[model samples]
Target: MASEHLHAISADWLKSLEVASSTGDSTSFVSHFLSDGWLRDLLCFSWNFRSLSGLDKIHRFLSEVVDGKPRFEHSGLRDFKLDDHTANAPSPFKLPGPQGIEGVQGAFTFTSTKPAALGRGFFRLTQDADGKWKALTLFTDMQDLIGHEESSSDQHGLYEGRKITWEEDVEAKFRAIEADPTVLIVGGGQSGLMSAARLGRLGIRALVVEKNARVGDSWRQRTTFPKYMPKGKLANFLDSYAVDQELCVWLSSSIASTPVYNASSARWTVEVQHGDRKVIIHPKHLVLATGSGSPRIPTWNGMEEFQGALYHSDFHRDAEQSRGKRVVIVGAGNASADICEDFVAHGATEVTMVQRSATCVISSTTAEKIIFKVPFPDGTPIEELDFRYNSMPKAFVLQLQVSGGTEHVKMFDKELHDSLRKVGFRLTWESSPGSGEVGLEGFVFNRQASGTMLDVGCSKLIVEGRVKIKQGQDISHFEKDGITFKDGSKLSADVIVLATGNEPIMKTARGLLGDEITDQLSPPEVLGLDSEGEFNQVYRPSGHPGLWFASGSFEFSRPSSKHLALQILARELGLA
Candidate 1:
C-alpha cells in the first residue's frame, strides 16, 4: 500500500473518533464509522470482531476491543491496529467507542507474517479526552528500518560485526618496518647485492659491503671453460650426437640478462680485510654473501710418518705433477671424477679411486636429456645407458688389526671392485692387515690384469674423508707437526690444504658499524645457516638499519643475487 494512503486513512479515523467523543452520540459515531468501508474493515480486523451466533460473542469482542490484550492491560489499548492488509473486507462485529468522552491512549505493535519481505514496526498511541487513541510516533529511526531491509538480502557473512584488540594493532605496526628505509646490506655476492639493489630501487638508501677483491668471486673461481677430448672425434661426438637441443632454445628465450662485473654506480665495495686493516664503510644494513669453501681435513694414523708429498683437492692445481706417479683419488662426487680425469690426462702411471658408497654418475646422454628435454631419435631413453663410463671411486678398505695382535685384514666388498673394473680400473686387496698402532706405515695395493696379477706400490697416499669445521681456533693447530687427530694418532704429511668452505665476510661493514650493531644487522639464520650448529650466529655483531638480507634457506630455492641487487637498487631509488 502507498504510505500516503495509510497516512490519510489514519488521520481520517482520528478525526471521526474526536467528533463522536465530543458529541456523545452513539448513533452519529456508528454512522460515521459505517460510512467508510476501508476504515470499518481495518477496525474490525484489528479488533478480531467475527460473525457468531449469540450475544456472548458480541460481549467477548467488545471486551477485547475495549480492554486490549491481557499483556498490555496496564499500558492501555491492544489489538486496535490491523496486522496486515488483505484483498477481502474484514468480517463485521461491534467495537468499543470512547466512554463518557474520556481519552483512550495505548501502544500497538504491527508485525508482518512474511518477515522476509517486510519487518515489524512499533508505535505509541495517545488519545485526548475528546478522541480515541491514534499513532503518535514510531519507536525507531528511519536508518534502522533501511538497515534491517538490507541485512535480509545479504547471504554472505561479510557484513558481520567485528571486534579488534590492542596487541594485534601493535604487531601490525612493527611489521610495517619491512617498508622502512633504515635497513643495511652487507656482502656483494648474489644475496647481499640483490637485496641492496632492490632496496635502493624502492627509494631506500641501501649500501652494499663486500670483502672480496672482486664481485662474483664464486663464479670466477669455478673457472669454467669449453671441455674437449682427445682425437677431436670425441669432441665432435659430444658437440653433435650428445648435445641437448633444448639448451639453445632455453638460452635464446630466457629473460635473464648476463651479469656485468663492474657497474657504473660503484654501489658495491670490495677488498677490506678484518683485524689487520681499518676501513670505514658504514651501512645501515648488512648481508653475508660468503659461501662455502674448501673441505676440512680429519686426523689419521701414519700421516706424520709419510715421507712423500700429499695434497688436498683444493691445492691440486697442477695435474702434470702426478706424471708416472701412482695416485689414489678419494671421494665419489663430481670433485673426485674431475680429479681422476685430471690424473689420467696428465699420464699418471696408475690411478685408483676410493669411495664410501656406490657412485651414481650421469651419462653424457642423460645430462643432455636433462638440459634439452628431447627424446632420442631411436626411442631409447637416456636413463637406460650404462654409467660406468663416468664412474668415480666407490669405497676404500683399510687393513687393520688390534695393537700387538696378529695382522688380519678386513677387505672392501668385491662388488665395489667389479664395478670399478667395468670402467678400466684395477683393485688390489691386501692379504695382511696392518696393526692398529699409532705409527705411520706404508699402504700396499695388488694390481689385477686380464687373468694376470701384478703389484703396484706407492709411497704417497691421499686421504679423503668427511669435511671438518673448527671455529675460534688457530688454523695452524689443524696439523701441528704434520700430525693431528682428535684421538692421538701420529699421522704424517708434508703439506695440508684445507677444503673447508668459505663464508661471506662482512669485515668492512663490521668495522664501520661496530660489533654490537653488526650482530643485530646480520644474522646467520637469515642466510641459511643452522640455528643450533657450530657455525650458527656467524655475523659480526654490529651493522646499520639500511641493510637487508637476500639468501636461500635449506627448504627454499636461492634467489639470483644479481637480479636481487638490481631490484633492491631500483626500489631504493624509486625506479622500480
Candidate 2:
C-alpha cells in the first residue's frame, strides 16, 4: 500500500509547492512533513544555509521563499522506491532494504527551469505509518561552473617556461614580476591545500602560506593525526596534492599583521613573516582552513595548585615518553580514548579516565563500516561518492543512519555496549522517530558536543581493567601529592592530561583580525545548525565580504574546498 499510495502523496506535495509559490499558503505546503519533521538546507539553491524543523519553521520558510513566486515546481519529479524497484541500486541509493526502512524508502529529483543547467535538486523521502510520503531531506545547490580560462601565454605560474637557471638571477625575475594573486590562504593543511588545488585549475592566482617548516608536517605537529589515514581511511581525498599540479605552499611563514581588505581595489593586504623577512602580499580573498576545536583549560581550587605535571591536549606529544608513570587523563571523548590506548601500550603504571557526563560510544569497526564502507566501497570513485553524499541534505543521511544504526545495535555487539556500562561509562544510542529506541551511527551527524566516543581499542583496555574509570567527579583542588574531587575523593597522579576540549576557531580569530574587525564580525559556528539550518560555513561568505571559513572532516573539506574555490574565482573574474 505504501508503494501504491506514494503517487498521490507525491502529487499532493508537488501541488502544495505550486500553491506556496503563488499564494504563500505555507500551511498547505508544510502539511506534507511529519509532525516533528526536519528540513536542513545546505548550499542548495538558497546560496546559503537554511534549516527549518517542525511545522512552524517549515511554514515560515515556505512563506519567505515562496512569497508570490510563480511556478516554483520547476520540473516533474521522478520517483524511486527503495525496496521494490531500486533494490539493486548502488551503495547509498539502495534504500534500506525492508529491514533498513521502517516503512518505505523513497526518493525523487527535479531540475531547474533556468537556462544553462544552472539549478537542480535531490530529495529523499520516507513513508510514515499513515502510508504517505514526506521529504526527509532536500539537497539543492547550483551546478558546477564551466567557464574556460583565458591566458595570453601558453603557460602560467612563477618561473613557468623560464630559461633562467637556479644559479642565475631567479630571485630578480621573481621580484620583477608583478601579478597580485586573487586569493591568500592561511593554514596550509588539508582544507587550504585542497582549495588551492581547485583554484589553480581555474587559472586563478592563489598563494598558500603555512607556518610549518615543510609540507605534510602539519599532521606531524598534531600527534600524527593522519597516521591512521591509510588509502581506505582517507578515500580519494588529497587527490589534488597527489596529482601533477603542485599548488605552492610557503613554509615557515606566519601572518605578521592584521589583514585589511580594500574595497577600492577589491584586494587584501596581508603582512606575512617568512623567517625574519617580512613579505607583503595583496590577494583579493582570504581563506582560513584552521581547525575549529576550542581548547579547555580547567582551574582547580586551593593554593597555586601543587601538581607534578599538568597540561591540556594542545601540548600532548605522545604516551611512550610517559611509560611507567602514573597517568590520570581527564575527559572521555575520542581523544581521551585514543590517549588511553597509547598509555596502556606504552606501559603507563596507572591510567584513569574521568567523565563528567554521559557520552555516545560506537566501536571503531562499526564506525568504519558506517562512515567509510557504506558510501565509499572499493571500485567507486570519490567524485561519485562526493556527489551522492554531498548532494543529499544532512537530514537524509541522519534518516538512513538512524534506521541502519538501530539494526546494528540490536544484532551486532551487545557485549561491547554491555561491558562499558559494567565499568560505569555512561552511553546513549542515537534515537530517532520510528527507528527503535537507539540510533547507531547517528552521532557522526550530531550538531552538539553531544559527548560521543568512537572507540578504537581503548574500550578493551578499560574493560580489562588496564584503564580505570573515575566517573562523575570534578576536581576540587590539587595538593603536592594528588588532586581532590568535588565528591571529596582523591587520586594521586604523576601527571594530569586534560582532554577536556578546545576553544572555537573564532576565539583566536581576534589575534589575526584585530579587535575592531573581529569585534564587528559575527562569529562563525563550527558545528550544529545555524539559523538558516546550515551546519557548515565553508566557501560561504561570513558577515564580512572577502572573508571565509573552512572546517569539517576530510570528507566534507575535500569537496567543499572546490565549492569555495569556484565561488571565489567567479567573484574575481566578475563571472558571478
Candidate 3:
C-alpha cells in the first residue's frame, strides 16, 4: 500500500462499532469483523476467558436479538460510546511482510454482563486485501473498577454472601485450617495471586503461602526497578503489588519439607514454617510460583585480597553506601546499568560497568513499539496485550513478531544505537529463533537466558563516559583496594557489585521442593513445552502428578493461572 493510502486509513473504522453498539444491533455489530475473524472474549464475555474462532460462533455469540444460547448481551460493544473514540493508529510494530497487517487501535468501555459492570478493552482493526478493515483481534475484559462484584468469573460459593469480620477473615484464613484444602500455591506473586483468584472463582478452596509478610512482598522485595517499569523513589518497587490478603495466605513462612504424596489418599502432605511456628496441611494440588531464583554469583579468580565491599545485585540496593567511593559493576545487564546509574545518582566518585560480551541495548520506549504495539493505557486489561503477543504459534511468533519487531526497534533506536557504537561499546540486536540456535529475546523468554538491558538514560551515561565500560575481561584477582583483570588491566575500586543473572527454575525447584522430586524434574537446559503448549511446565502436569509450575511473564500470568486452576478443578471432579 502507498504511504498516502496508509495515511488515509485511520481509526475512523471504530465509528461503525460505536454506531452498531449504541443501537443494540447485533447484526450490525458482527458486520464489523471479517467472516473468518476470531473473537477472543477474555474477561468481558464471561470473566472466565473464552474464544470463538469463526463468523458463525462470532455471530451466535454476539446476536442478542435471536435469543437461544447465541444471545450475548454485551456484544463486545456493550454501552460503547462514540465519545470514547480514541485513535492510536499507525502502530510502531509491523506484522512483517507476506501477511502484512495494517492495524489501527481503538479502546472503549462496555457494560460487562452476567451481573452488569463497567468493562474496558483494546481493539485492533486490520485492513484486509480487499481494502476493507475488520476486527482481526478483539480483547474484552472487565475494567476491574471499584466495587465490581463477582460476575461469571466466580461460581456462587459458601463465601458468596457471608459478611465476615476482619478478625474472622484473618483467623479463619490463617489460624484455622480446613482439614483438606483443594490446592496449595507456594509464593504469592502475580502467578500465585492470580491462580488463587482463579481457583477461588472455580469454587475450589485454595491457600497461597508466601515467605514474606505481605502479599506483594515478592514485588516489594525487588529493591531495584526496571527502566521500563515505574521508578521508585522511597517505595521498594513502583509496580503492581496486588493486595491478596482476602485470599488464604500464610505469610512470613516457607515450605518446611519435601511434600509427600500418598497413593491411598491421592493427596499431598505439605509443611510450612512461619517463624517459630510450623504448620502442616494436606492438599490435592501443589503449585510452585516462588519465581525463578536468586542472583547467580559467578566465580572470579579473585584471591579474596580486596578489602572492599562485595555483593550480588539482589543485595546492592542501597547506593548511599557507595557515596564518594569508586564503584565497579561486573555485568552489562539491566541491573548492572541500574546500579551504575544509582551509584552516580547517589554521589559515587566514579562508576564503571564491566561488560563481558556484546549487549543488546534498546531505548526504554522501544518496548511500547514492540510490546504494547501502541500507547495502550496502563489500565487496559493485560489479557488484551497477552493474547496479541502469545496467541500465535511459537514458531510463527519467532518469524513474524520478533523479526518484524526488531526492524522497527532499529528505526526507533537509530540514535541510541549509533551513540553506543561511537563509544567502544559493542551492541547487537535481539534475536529471532529462526535466525539462530537461540537469540536474546527467545533465550530470555523461552530458555531463561541472560537479559539485555533497557537503556533508560543509562546509555547516555555510558556514551558520555560518565559511566565507563570495561569490555571482555574477567576479574583475575583483587588487590588490597583494586582489581586486576585477565586482560592485564588494573582498576581501583572501593566496592564491586555482581549483577550476574540467576539459576534456572529447576535449580530453585530442587532446593525448595526436594532433591528427590528435583532429580525427577526435567533437565535444567531444557525448556518444556508440555502437551498444552505452555512453557516451563506451567498450567500443565509436570512429570509428577498434582505438581505444576506457573512462572513467566507477570502480565500473562493471569491467563496461565486460569489454565492451571481449571486443570486442577477438572481433576478434582474427575473430568480431566
Residue-level lDDT of model 1, residues 517-572, one tens digit each, is 45665443333222111112222122232243344321111222322343234334
Candidate 2, superposed: residue stretches over 4 Å from native: 1-44, 50-138, 148-179, 224-227, 230-243, 302-307, 396-411, 429-450
CA lDDT scores, all candidates in order = 0.31, 0.62, 0.64
Best by TM-score: 2
lDDT of 3 by residue, 226-264 (tens): 444542332232113333224677678898878897868
Q: How far is 538's C-alpha from truth in model 2 (Å)?
A: 2.9
**Model 1: how far residue 163 lies from native, Å:** 60
The better-scoring model by lDDT among 1 and 2 is: 2
Candidate 3 stretches greater than 4 Å from native? 1-99, 102-170, 173-178, 224-245, 373-385, 401-404, 430-443, 447-449, 523-534
- TM of each candidate vs. truth: 0.32, 0.76, 0.71
- 10 residues in a row with least lDDT, candidate 2: 75-84
lDDT digits (tens) for residues 1-576 of candidate 2: 444565455445555654553343446656766776665543333445566667776666544533244222322122222222232121123443234543223333333332112333444556677867666554444444434432223233434477655434334422332246677788777778778777776677667777777665555545433236643234234433623345656679879999998889777888989778998888878888766544767777652565577877667777788888998888887778877777787898999998876667777677566556766767756855675566555554554545554555434557888898898887766433343323543444443443577677788888999999998456788787677888889888887888877775666676678777666665455455444535645567676778887777677877777667657765665644
Worst 10 residues of 3 by lDDT: 233-242
Task: Please list the residue runs of candidate 1 whose C-alpha ends up more than 4 Å from where it truly belongs after superposition.
Answer: 1-212, 223-277, 302-311, 358-360, 371-576
Q: Return the clash pairs for model 3, or none.
A: none
